[model samples]
Target: MKVRDFMIKDVLTVNQNAPLSEVLQLFVAKRINGAPVVDADGKLTGMVSDGDILRYINPTRQTVYDMFSYVFVSPPEELAEALAYKVETPAKKIMKKNVQSVSPEQDLEEALGILAKHHFKKLPVVNEKKEVVGVISRGDLLKQIAGRLNELNAKTVSR
Candidate 1:
């Protein structure tokens, strides 16, 4: 099967210039873990995931080294503080650039390979113009495979 056969056509995306707070809201509201980042013209520029947001909001640790064996440590910044500081940051600042993507015409094998090799949960399906046409998640592939397996099992039972 090709990507277009099972890929989700109603893809949710975020603008590159959008703030992290808005991105977070979108993720939560849509119940999605990630989305493709688009430029002003709606072309795919990068990708962002919930993990990326968590990493960005992680607080920095403070440590100081005093003489030979002396050391001082300060409490890490609060999570809320870190979050407040980065909430207004632009999506382009944290989104992963040069993301691997697939075309709608590509075979499922190609999509599977890319997803496994890169440890990606989802991939953006793009058109010739590099516009995001759809998205394929690991769940989509697994669901298709499960259905096919059930069909084969039923055939064997009938025989």
Candidate 2:
């Protein structure tokens, strides 16, 4: 099987200029962990994930000396304040640019290799023009494997 055979043709994408809050809302509404960032022409530029959004909420590091010298250490509330400040920022600021992509015609083994090597959950399938046509996830491959296994079991039962 090839990537095109199992990939989702309709992908939910976000524009670079979209506000981070909108992006977060979309993720919640769609129940998706990430989205492909696309340009005005609908070309894949980057991707943003829930992990990237959560990074904004991490407390800024301070030197150990500063931690001891300060009258009060930064509290968890400070992290929330910092994240609130970034909620309206554009997607361009947080999207991952060095994305790993696959061609639609590529074999499933190549897709599996890419996913395994990078620990990626999904890969964007592109065309000759590098335009994203679909996306394939690890779950899709697993489902295909399960179907084949069931078929083999049926054949064995018949024999």
Candidate 3:
């Protein structure tokens, strides 16, 4: 099977200039873990995921010293809190640009290989012109497999 057979054509995308808060809300409202970020011409630019949002909301420790300092020092804690709050300022600032994309004509195994290698939940499906037309997720692949199994079972019962 090909990616086009299972990919979702009606993909939900967000503009690069969209506010981070709005983007976060979209994720929640759509019940999606991530979305492809497109340009004004609807060209794929980057991707933003729930992991990115979590990283922004949750401050990371720079080092053991920084962790200790923050724990012992009140100012560092305040600074960390302030920075986490600032993370909701914009989408362009937090979106990952080095995205891995797939074409609709690609085989399902190829798409699975890419997703496995990169540990991605979904891949943006781009056309020959490099414009994103859809997205394929792991769940989509599983659904396809289940459908095939059901068909096989029905055929066996009929025989």
Off by over 4 Å in 3: 60-88
lDDT of candidate 2 over 1-159, digit per residue (tens)? 888887889888889899998998999999998878888887888888889888855666653345556765543456667777887889988889889999888998899999899988878887887677888788878898899999999999999
For lDDT, the strongest prediction is 1
Worst 10 residues of 1 by lDDT: 63-72
Model 2 regions lying over 4 Å from their true place: 61-77
The lDDT of model 2 is 0.84
Off by over 4 Å in 1: 65-75
Report lDDT (CA) for all predictions. 0.93, 0.84, 0.84
- TM-score per candidate: 0.89, 0.85, 0.83
Model 1, span 1-159: residue lDDT tens: 888997999999999999999999999999999999999888999999999999999898986757778877777799888887899999999999979999999998999999999999999999999999999999878998899999999999999
Query: What's model 3's overall lDDT?
Result: 0.84
